[model samples]
Target: MNEVGVIDWGIVGAGHIAHRFAQGLAHVRDARLARVWSRRTESVAAFVQRHGGEGCGSFDDLLASDIDAVYIATLNDSHAGYARAALAAGKHVLCEKPATLNAGELRAVLETARVSRRLFMEAMKPPFFPLYRTLCEHLRRDPIGPVGLVRAGCSVANVPAEHPSFSLDTGGGALLDIGVYEMFLAVDWLGAPLDVQTFGRIGASGVDTFASVHSRHEAGIAQLFCGLDLDGKGDALLAGPHGYVWIHEKWWNPVRATVSYAGGRVVELNVPFEGGGLNYETAHFCELIRAGELESPIMTHEKSLRMISMLDAARSALGLVFPGE
Candidate 1:
């Protein structure tokens, strides 16, 4: 942090998602973009010009800068390595979702955070949204009786073959890329699953282009569908014995939701925001650093481990294995 109390942030990637994240930083008053590093010099230069940051010649240069934390927006397979490096450099780490390729890699990163005594978090944005918090409060009050089923899906049209998300070596798949959002909502709301089943359509690249998962929780069941080869309705529903909650289109980053009782009583909510939804997570990360916290209570390490474990189980059931896994 500088003398003005602004936490300097170094970005580790210059991809599309990284651009979204940089845009999000504009809404966080306590944080400032400090440096950016990417293999592509032109990409990094453009990112800095738009986001008010300097372009580092290399990842090492970014780590050596006067930054309080590093926001890693790298490809799926590179998440663990960059996170470990940033932590070792004594900078807090905020890595994007699917924090690691598997539970084993996640464990290694967690161990590094412990040894380094630095804050580490998986940048799962949905859980940090105000709408999600409100829904959680309603669920706590049992406004929907006991939730018995959760149905959620997130899908998008396929990208070009050259995109990293389409390559198995880069940890590309519908599950790890988009499906984790659905999985997070289910696990966070329903707890760990006792039984898991999955089926997937593998593309020529040995990645799951489409996948469906069923997880049996103690109190209910969660049904999830995700794909990269097609488009979906992008919605989610939580139905209980006496009522249900409906998250509007693009449920993962929704701005609205509705709750209805069996008797026909209904209530709707609108969650307004500035910039992209990524701001919520960015602000929360800065808050944690200001408080000298090593982990986020909302997105705890155990929660990340559990999420990845479920992903691993589902992938195994579908016979979807990444390269060198």
Candidate 2:
């Protein structure tokens, strides 16, 4: 509601992603945390006290506050519900990714946003970063010629089942938790694949511990894998008829990439981020809110839905299902 200044915002969760979102907001001069809310009263109180934010009694109370936007950092299952509530209450929403478990849930959230005439964005975070922007530009310029093949994977090891990250009920798994990032980056950069094949290891709890998926497109093909059982590395390589461009540490935060072209000519590109690389998205959200845009053209509702659809297909192929899916 504050015109000519930073937008007032309420943070809906006080978890790790909430912390990072708050930290990222710090880099933006035109956004202010108006309130903080969490079911855990003590946690919300602590977060408010540390960040100098007012403590709202409940998430509903936070929505009732005179805030322009609500950042939903809750669990995967709670994303749609929270976003729906916020949109209905006439507040813009920027939720952390997989924004919803499946395409249907995502569509429901987007429809709510449409009816309420409020903005809704998935906080995929990495795509809005400087590194991705640079990559997009380079690829558009055909810096590496036509891409031939791309190999992308995201993996981590030794995650305990007790952690909420491993919980199948709230939509936890290797592919959903981390693989989505790889899939998003691949599809975002290369467009939808003509066909996709998946293979992976599922845990006893009915969660995917490891997954390998091959995506074939008209231009080229991408091979993607993700898992928790084995300690693996995540990287994205855009190979062309002549050579390839390698994105180092691709999935989460890509800071550097090496481009190798014909005659073995190699060039290393570095993404020098000013802040946490989160500022780019934070700034983008603020800009969209100011402009009264309901969805980002780059990360549109359709894009989010399509990506989740792919995830659902992969899960189905793996015969993996969360508790109530």
Candidate 3:
């Protein structure tokens, strides 16, 4: 940040999520894409050409360059490594969800961020979306009582075989890739996961193709499911003693919600998003960087740890361990 207080960002992995990050970056004030790097040279070149960033020759170049932060948008397997390297290099890091392969791995990366004394936040975008924020405010003002249960799920069966979600080596599966979102909702509304029970099937690719998770949190219980071989509905529910909140289908990219109370009173919330849904999280990260915050108050490190821990337990129950685990 120079006199004008602008932040430059270097990105790892010019993949699908990275493209969304770049698109969202356009909506973040005073943040610019400084450098882009990925495994494939051609992908790097193409991404840079489309997204208005200089293509870096290698990851070392991207880190060594004079950038204020790093966004780890790589696959699940590499999120921890890139986040650790970025924080160790004295850059604030905003890594994609799951943060790492498992709770143990996330702990190591978080320790690195702590020693580095830099901001590190998992890119959990739902809380920042307008609809979600509105829901929080409404709950605070009107009261939803103590939320005691959370239920959510998302699954798609048409994913191509070549997609990384089916690849066991890259740490792809419905749990880490999709279930993490549901877990985040549970942890946010309920609390730290105390116990997790799961039932699932591992596909021929040696990865979990579908999973159903039932978890006990400090404050409540959660029922979540994720799959790459089923097309289940993708809505979410939060039940309380006095009422309930319903985040409509595709809740992860939430736009609408309804609150129903014990008195038969009802309220509907609809808040649209722009510049893609990822911008909200990107903007929040930028604000945290400026404020010298190490952990996000909303997307706290504790919440991330709890979410991934639930996934770890679920994976363990399913006997779906990635290589080198």
RMSD of each: 1.4, 1.6, 0.8
lDDT to native, each model: 0.89, 0.82, 0.93
Select the stronger candidate by TM-score from 1 and 2.
Answer: 1
> Model 3 clash pairs?
none
Clashing pairs in 1: none
How far out, in Å, is residue 12 in model 2? 1.3
Q: Model 2 over residues 1-325: C-alpha lDDT tens digits?
A: 7768679989988998888778778888878888999989999988977776799998888888899999998888788899999999999998888899888889999999999999999888777878778877876775667665878886778777686667788898887788888777667756776777899877877688888988776566778888888888777877877778888875468789888887888877798677666678778988998887889988877678767877888898988776656
lDDT of 1 at 280: 92
lDDT of 2 at 263: 82
Q: Name the runs in model 3 displaced over 4 angstroms.
A: none
- Ranked by TM-score from best down, the candidates are 3, 1, 2
Lowest summed lDDT over 10 consecutive residues: which window, candidate 1? 138-147
- Could you tell me how far off, in angstroms, the CA of residue 79 lies in candidate 1 after the best superposition? 0.4
lDDT of 1 by residue, 181-296 (tens): 88888887777777888988888888888999999976789999999888888999999888999999978787889999899989897886667889999899999999999999
Of the two candidates 1 and 2, the one with more favorable lDDT, higher being better, is: 1
Per-model TM-score, in order, reads 0.96, 0.95, 0.99
How far off is residue 214 in model 2, in Å?
1.1
Model 1 regions more than 4 Å off: none
Give the per-residue lDDT of model 3 (tens digit) for 71-126. Answer: 99998999998899999999999999879999999999999999999999999999
